[model samples]
Target chain A: MNKILKSIYMPILAVIIAIIIGSIIMLVTGFNPLAAYASLFIGAFGTLPNIANTLANAVPLIITGLGVAIAFNAGLFNIGAEGQYWIGAIVATWIGYSFKGLPWYIHIPFALIGAMVAAGLWGGIVPGFAKAYTGAHEVITTMMMSYVAIYFSHYLLEFGPMMEKGSVPQSPLIKDSAIIPTILRNTQLSYGIFIAIAAALFVYWLMYKTVWGYEMRAVGFNQRASKYAGMNVPLNIVLSLSLSGIFAGLAGAVQILGVQHRLYDSFTSGYGYTAIVVALLAKNNPIGVVFSALLFAALGTGSQYMQLNAQVPGQLADVITGLIIFFVAADKIIEVLKSMFKKQKKEELAS
Target chain B: MKEILLNPQLWSATLAMATPLALPALGGTFSERSGVVNIAMEGIMLIAAFFAVLFAHLTGSAWLGLLGAIVVGMIVAVIFAWAAVTLTADQVILGMAINIFASGFTAYLLNTIFGFSGTPTDTPMLPNINIPVIKNIPFIGQILSGNSVIVYLMIILIFASNYFLFHTNLGLRIRAVGENPEAAETAGINVIKLRYLGVALSGLFSAIGGAYLSIGLLNSFSTDMSSGRGYIALAAMIFGKWTPFGSFGAALLFGFATALSMQLQNSAMSKNIIMMLPYILTVLALVGVGGKSVSPAADGVPYTPKK
Candidate 1:
């Protein structure tokens, strides 16, 4: 219980503090934070559809956050989840639209595997090998790769071979057989939620139940020690980052198959970057990612309603998200505050 | 190809594009050399760009706007420094947080202050200077004479930063602390203060880059108008091997790629493909040269002075 509480405490405190700060910003800017937050809450969970939509929004975050968390476990920062998944989406969309006759089961799995391989190669193999062989920083390489992927996606949808017959720069809609069935008709939620949950479970298993994970975590903890122990540190780095890319690619595949149904021009909902914060808030735990992703998705889904009702901009969600990351990153201040309060209480009792 | 090569406009555009990237790359050198891996140049450039437009609009002077933005950027750098250096938080995470915050805050403020239409049309912009004697020189004159004032300033800063970083006692001390904070501390050098100065300098330079985008090049602030130039600047820094002149050279190369793309916009080749040039170049450059450029030892480690 204490272990779980300790894990949960910091994130909860960070969120509360961030929200308070966000409220103060709203107040200083001459807006009523109460109304904005109230509407935001309602919009996220007021009705069945709202709840469903919130969960649906969380699906991609859960998957991407898991990817980031796994990378963190290996002491790798795969900041290019954005780019990895962009490549994945492009590949998945192409497979979904172009494949003429496969059933959903075969077609979906095929697209997913193909995307994972392509994206893993793009996001993982190059950077992983580069970092392993040459001492190149994955942070820089991954980030650069992301831009390359983003611009390449635009090329495909806008003017490249993937562009459909219309004047608008949108690809053709994925075939009906490729679409992941929604849980309920007319609802945004899909079985992709299950995929996200499964991915989390799979990550938990990989990290805790397997020797591969043990070695990977060991490498992350101390590379020199791991190397001394005869573990292939370089290979682990490549494997860990590649797995992270696979998960990122999986996220793109799921989103394409489930929610979007087609690739839009430069379709970035920023799930990639936000996944970093989600993983951070979760302390890089796979199970914790689910809840963290949900919390962020709530903020995201609710932002529109808050905008409509409270005359607040939807961008406030990003602000709140940023603040949460800040609080989390500088969490030493929280410990100081907590200890300071304890000292005060001790003095008060003595008095 | 001949027509494109002959155009002085392309050369000028290369310098113009290079200014924003070079400034940030140069700024990143100071921070990294002082042992802080500052990925926050992207965020700094963004926030500074927004504030530059806001202050310029309010004061009716672009120069005042630039001043206001520098103060704002320095303030942000101080906050970042507090997190990275004082609190010893993860510098990468702190930098990412600042970038996200800058993006959100700028977008929110832009909407609140400027409305949906965007920044005021009459918002002041830094003037393009036409050097009197230089304007008369042939092709070289056209490329160098007519450009934003900040472009010239960036060139001057490159040289100044070189002299400050390589040829000065302060520079040596900063490098010493970065390479070995404990050793520097044992020698009675204040590591924390120097680190703060390095980070603050980064903020100053990044602010210039951000302002170059919103005011120096364009007259208005748009959402994420700095785009990924800050990241590109980061690539430039690494490619240049973390030296001021090297970063400037890398930035010039990237800027030339961008200029080439701009020139190619008229050609039959797709525009989106052209846009990928700089990013692709960055990836290739890192692969080719990034391995050889070793970072300062203890570059990202948080220093806690032993009592």
Candidate 2:
């Protein structure tokens, strides 16, 4: 119980501090903080439609956050989820549009699974192999691969095989069989939210209830010790990154089949960095990713309303997000401060 | 291919394009050599680029703009150093957060202050310097001289950095600290202080690179004007094997690839495909297509002194 509270309390404190600072910035910049925040709050959760929209927006973030959390749990800094998302999106689009006359169940499953497998292989083959074989840092290699994937998508939609024959650079719409139904009428919300939540549950099970996860976590804790204890360290590294790619690919696949319905030129997830923050906020807890992702999603949605209603730039959300990351990343300092406070209290009691 | 290779503009463009990458690549070399992984050059460069134009627009002096950028850059470096060194946070995460923060902050400021007209068109620009002696030489003069003033500054800084990192006691001590902090601490060396100095130097040079983009290469700032050059500089840092001269050479090569892509834009082959050369090459370089890249022994590992 104490351990759980220790993990939960810091993020809450960090979020509160970040919001207070954000309000201070607004006041300093001559904006009415109360009005801005009021509109922000309403825009995020005031109405049923607004809440639905927030949850809809959170679908991609939740999936990607879980993807990032998986990598984080294994002590891997996998910033290349953006690239993996791209690869999955294109693969799903290709599979979605290519096949015809198939039932919805067969077609959807086929496309989704295909995307996950290919993207998983991509994550394993490129950065994973490079890191395992040549000792290349995944940070550089994965980021480079993201550009490669993004540009590859651009090439495809612009004039390559996937381009629809129109002035706009985009792929042909997915077949009707492959399309995901809308969960809420007249809103962006889609049935993909269920998949996203399922992914979180799946991740929790995979990371906690399985033997593979145990070995992976052990390797993450101490690679040398794991190796000495007869674990295949390199395989675990490759597997951890591959699994990260799998979840990221699922985000892309679901977005394509459910939301985008087609591939467009210059297509990018744009959730790469945000998802990392979500994972960090949740402290890599799979279940906690849902709440953390929702929180960020709310900030994004509310800030847009804040921009329109209060004349405050939505970019303020990003600034606040950054401040939260600072406080969270400096968690050791928070621990130190807590210890100092505890000591002072004890001294007071003694006196 | 032969005509493109022999074209003088291509070589000069290589030099022009390389100044941005080389400066920051040199900066990365310093930061990582001191054992702090700084992926925040993109953020540093973006913030500095904006401030560079802001100051230049306000004062009508490009030099003053450069000074303002350096000051802001050093302040950011201090925060980064304090976090990565004192707080012993994850340097990579710190870098990423700062990158996101800088992007949003600059965009918000631009929207609020400039009202979306963008920076003033008449913002003062750093003058190109014509080397008097070299202008007489054919072909070589155009490639080496008569470039942006920052290009020349970058060249000088490269030579200065090469010497300082190798031939000085302070430089040796910095490397010693990065290689083994505990040993350095045991030997009466201040590990944290040296790391701060090293990271601060990165800020100084990255500021120059960012300022070069806004006032040195162009007259004003635009959103995300750094355009991933900071990451390219990281690639160059690795390709060049983390040395000043090597990074310069690698930057020139990558710059050549970029210049080549620009030249081939009018050709029949896919332009986007050609644009991907540098990125793909970056991957190849990392997978040992160029050579095996090595890092400092303690690079990216936060050092918390044993209490």
Candidate 3:
């Protein structure tokens, strides 16, 4: 219980501090902070529809956050989640459009699997191989690969086989069989949230219960020591990154199969980048990612209302998100302050 | 293909495109050489680009806009230095946050101040300086003359940076700190101060690059006008093996690829395919060259003074 509380404490405090700072920014920008924040709160949770929308927005974030968390646990920074997401969407779109007259169960699973495999191979295995065999840094390699994925997807959507009949740079709609059913009426929320939750649990089990997880953790803790202990460092690196890609790819598949139902240009909308902050805020814990994803999703969903009702720009949400990440990244500030307070209390007692 | 390769106009366009990349790539050389990985160049460029246009519009002076951008860039760099140096935070994460912050802040400010998502036209632009005798001198002149002052400055910077990194005492100290902070400290070098200086200079150079994009090459700023050039500069930095001249060459190669793509846009092939050239080339360059490049020994590691 104490451990759990300790884990939760810093993130909670970070969010509170971020909100206060955000309010100050709003006020300085000549907007009513209270009204803006209140409306934002109401817009995110005022009705069942609002709540569902927020959850729907969160599904991809949670999955991608888990992806980032897993890789970070293995001491790898997988910044290519965006690329993985794109490739997954492209593969899922191909399967969705090409297949016809198939049962829903078969087609949906096929698309999802295709997304996971293709993206895992391209975004995860290839970079992992580079890092393992050639000593390439994952940060630069993943970023470069992301551009390849992005433009490759752009080529496929705009000028390649998947191009729709119209001029719009998007794929034709997926067959109804591939669509993940909507769970809530009058909202974009779908049953994908259940899949996200299940994946979160699976990640938790994998990172904590499995032998591979133990080896990966050991390697992350100390590569030389793990190699000395007979762990295959290169293989663990590859496996860890591949696992990260799998979750990121699943996020793309869910977004396409569950929400968009087609491959569109620039569809991921920085979900991959945002996942970095989510994982960080969660301290790279899979379970914590779910809650952090929800918080961000709420902010995202409410920002539109904040724009329309309070005359604030929707980008304000992004600013707030950045602030939260900044505060969280500087979490040592909180630790230092806490230590200082303890010292002060001790002096008071002595006096 | 022969005509395209031999055309002076193509070379000129490549050089023009290369200038923006070379500036930041050179800046990154200094920062990384001092053992501070500046992944926040993208965010710095974006914020500076926005301020460049805003100041140019307000004061109607392009030079003042450039100054404003540099000041803003240095301010942002100070925050980054404080976080990465003073707080000893993870440099990569902090860099990413700053990038996101710059993007969000610029967009929000544009909305509030400009009352629109994009920069308005009628903003003053920096004038191209045509070197009189040199500009009249045939094919060489076509490639070098009649470009903005920043282009000329970029070339001068490359030579200046090479000198500063290899020949100067301060350069030796910066390299010493990057190679081994403890040794540098033992030698009585102020490692922290050198690092802060390195990072601040990087911010200054990248801001000038940003200003060039906003007012030098184009008349006004658009949302996301920098458009991944910062990342490309970083790739160039690595591909060049963290040397100023090497980075300049890499930047030129990327620029040439972009120029080739633009040349192909008029052909029967799809524009999208042509547009992928630079990005594809970047990936190939990294795959081929990345492993060969060695970074500073203590790059990206925070230095905590031993008490």
Candidate 4:
């Protein structure tokens, strides 16, 4: 119980601090912080529809957050989640639109699986090979690859096979068979949230229960020691990245199938980048990512209402999110203060 | 393609494009050389570009705008330095946070200050400096003259940094700190001060690059105008093997690629395909130069003196 509380404490404090700072920023910018915060809360959770939209927004973040968390556990930074998400969306859309007259079960699973494989290869095998064999830093390669994927997606959507018959730069609607059914009658929320939760559990089990997880963590903890202990270090790197890619790819697939139902230029909406913050805020814990993802999703969903009702800029949400990351990333400040307080308390007791 | 390659105008365009990249690439060289991995160049450039235009617009002086950008950039760098250097936070995560902060804050400012979502049009741009004799000289002059003052400054900075980093005593100490902080500390060098200096210079140079993007390359500031040039500059820094001249050369190469694509805008080739050239080249460059480019020995590792 103590361990669980310890794990939850810092993130809760970080969120509170972030919101306070965000409120200060809003106040400084001439917006009513109380009104903005109240409206933001109301917009996110006051109504069933609002809650549904927030959950829908969170589904992708949770999945992508899990992706980043898994990679972090293996000591690999998978910054290419953006690109991997795009590739997955592209593949899923391609398969979604190409097939006809297929059963929903077969068609949906096929498209989603295809997305996972393609994105896994792009996010995992390609960069993994470079890092393992050529000693190229994955950080640089993954980031560069994201640009490649971005432009490539643009090219495909604008001029290639995915382009709709009209002038707009987007794909035709996916077949109904491939669409993930909405769970909420009047909102965008779908069964994808369940999939995300299941995936989180799977990740938890993989990280804590599996031998491969042990080897991967060992390599992450100390590559030299792991190699000395007869583990295949390079193979673990490849597997860990591949596993990370699968989750991010699934995020793309779910988002497209459940929400957008079409492919378009730059359609992933920076979920890949935002997932980094989600993973960090969650301290790279798969289970923790779900809650963090919901928090961010609430902020995102609430910001639109804040803009319309509170007369604040929608971009305020992003600023708040960034502040959250800043305070969280500099968490050593909190740790140091805590230790000082503990020492002082101990001294007083001794006296 | 041949005509585009042969056009003398292409060289000038390439130089103009390359100038923005070279400044930040050199800045990355300085910071990384001092053992601070600065992936926050993107964010820093964005903030500088935004503030440069804002100050220039408010004060009616491009020079003051440039100064404002540099000052703001340094302040941002100090925040990063305090976190990454003093607090010993994870540098990469902090850099990422800064990038997000810059993007969000700038957009927010644009809304509140300008009251519009589009690029500000009335802002003044920096004047071009056409060297009189050089402007009339020929193809060489055409390639080198009639650009913004920042372009000329960037070229001069390359040489200046090359000299400063390799030949100066301060440069030696900085390198010593980057290569081995404990040794440098033992030698009585103020490793923290040198690092602070290195990172500050990086912010200044990247801010110049950002200012160039707003007032030099384009006439006004738009959202995300820096695009991915900052990342490209970083790639150039790595591809150049973290040397001043090498990074300049890499930036020039990328600039030429960009110019080539611009020249091909009139061709039958798809514009999207042409747009992909520079990014594709960056990836290829990283892969081709893999295992060959070595960074500073202690790059990205926080330093703590022995107790």
Candidate 4 CAPRI-style tier: medium
lDDT of 3 by residue, A120-170 (tens): 897667789878887677888788778778877867876567889987878
TM-score of each: 0.97, 0.95, 0.95, 0.95
| Model 2 lDDT tens row, A1-351 | 999898899999989888898888888888888899899999999888889889988998899889888878877888888889898999999999999999999999998999899888877788888887887888888888877788788888776789898778789999999998888887778899999999999999989999898888888788889999999988888998899888888888998998889997764467867888999999999999999999999999999989999999888888889888888887777777889999999999999
Question: Ten consecutive residues with minimal summed lDDT in candidate 2 chain A?
Answer: A264-273
lDDT of 3 by residue, B1-307 (tens): 8988888889988998898899999988888888898888888999999999999999999999999999999898888888888788888888888888888888888888888747879888888889989998998888889889999999999999999999999999999988999999998999999999888988998999999999999978776678888888988898888999999998898888778777766542355565555555555555565446777998889999776
Q: Docking category for candidate 1?
A: medium
CA shift of B169, model 4, Å: 1.7
Model 2 score (lDDT): 0.87
Q: Per-residue lDDT of B45-85 in model 4, one digit per residue for the tens?
A: 99999999999989988888899999999999988988888
Q: lDDT of each structure?
A: 0.90, 0.87, 0.87, 0.86
RMSD of 3: 2.5
Candidate 1 C-alpha error for residue B114, in Å: 2.3
Candidate 1, residues A221-303: lDDT per residue as tens digits?
99999999999998999998888888899899889999898888864659999999999999999999999999999999899
Q: Once model 2 is optimally superposed onto the true structure by TM-score, how far is the C-alpha of residue B5 displaced, in angstroms?
A: 3.1
Cα distance off (Å), candidate 3, residue B192:
1.1
Worst-scoring 10-residue span by lDDT in model 1 chain B = B266-275
Which candidate number maximizes TM-score?
A: 1
Candidate 1 C-alpha error for residue B135, in Å: 0.5
Which regions in candidate 3 have their CA more than 4 angstroms from the true location?
Answer: A335-351, B2-8, B266-291
The number of clashing residue pairs in model 3 is 0
